[model samples]
Target: MKLLALDTSSEGCSAALWLDGQITERFELAPRGHTRLLMPMVRELLAERGLKPSDLDALAFARGPGSFTGVRIATGVIQGFAWGLDLPVVPVSSLAAVALSAMEQHQLADGSGVAVAFDARMSEVYWATFACRDGLPAMQGNERVCHPENVSLPDPDTTTDGWFGAGQGWKFVDGMPEAIATRIRSIDTSLVPRASQVARLAIPAFHAGQAVPAEQAQPVYVRDEVTWKKLPGRE
Candidate 1:
């Protein structure tokens, strides 16, 4: 399957192509450059592979809980591509993407848990926990946006030694409950979600018939329900 994935959900802007089973990606830590950089990265990836948008079977993106504008940028771009190519789209969770990326980087075993948190300004975080399942992240609970002091593990009672914390949200660990902090084996505050992991997480979903129409694909913002600002052409 030929799938194209993009993620602009954090300070990072990335585009990736999943060709058959091999994945190729271009990523940069360009905080506000996503609007100007994302499409070019997609173009470059497709050009290097001698493929066109029509050649792709599906599109994927990190759909939420990061920078509000960043999520909208990805959603708009993917929706436009999906409409033009008449392809299915897989909306992967930004938190899950972070978790899977952390798992790969740490070489964690299956069942090992990752608590992902994106530092949402105003002293809150976009948080969620996931367990590595067959090399993919399986969410342990609903994604939420909450104060660092309120952050938690879905199953704190379970063995916690295998759990690790990831993302900028970890910067606020000192404010979280001692119980939750103690359970985390360690923390990686430098990690950001990438399109490579988004593509990795979307492949199986695409194959399993989880891909959806462009109109049905939407960005997920875990906080401020009434304040969402969508990209142009979207209601």
Candidate 2:
């Protein structure tokens, strides 16, 4: 399968091309540079592989629960690519991508529990737990946005390695429930979702008929409702 993936769901901007079984990627920690960096990364990845947008069989992306602007950027880019190329798209969770990335980087065993959290602004976190299965992260529960103290943890008895934490939200470890804090064997504060992992997670889903039309693919924002106030005298 020749799939292209991109992620701009955090401070990082990345793009990947998964050809057959090998993957190549371009990534950078660019806080507000995604709009500029993302397309070039995609173009370069395809160019390096001696391919073009038409050569891709499908597209995938890290879809949400990170910087709101970042999530929108990735979603827009992937949707545009899918529409123009007439390819299917798979939206992988931003948290799931981080969890899978951590699992691979740490070489966690099957059944190892991974709890991923993104420091969602406004004193809350975007969080979820996953269990490593066959080198992939299978979410254990619904992803949510909540105060650090209310984030969920994996069931201790079910995982082989207690629990490991990943993402900037782990920076709030002191605020998390003690029950969760005590179970985490380690945490990676530097970790962010990447396109390579997004592609890896998407491969199985793509084959399983999870890929959708560009118009059908939508971003998943755990905390969906947003409130805004009109600017003074600017009705």
Which numbered prediction scores highest in lDDT against the true structure? Answer: 1
Worst 10-residue lDDT window for candidate 2 reads: 226-235
What C-alpha lDDT, on a 0 to 100 scale, does residue 220 get in candidate 1? Answer: 89
Q: Model 1 clash tally?
A: 0
What is candidate 1's lDDT per residue for 1-235, written digit by digit as tens? Answer: 8999999999999999999999999999999899999989999999999998899999999998899889989998888988878899999999999999898999988868899999999899999988777778888879999999998887654433479899999999889999988888888999999999999999989889899998877888988563554446767
TM, every model? 0.95, 0.94
Evaluate model 1: give its lDDT: 0.89
Model 2 scores a C-alpha lDDT of: 0.88
Residues 82-164 of candidate 2: C-alpha lDDT, one tens digit per residue: 87788999999999999988988999889799999899889999999999888888899799989999986755677876789
Candidate 2, backbone clash total: 0
Candidate 2 off by > 4 Å: 226-235
Model 1 RMSD in angstroms: 1.6
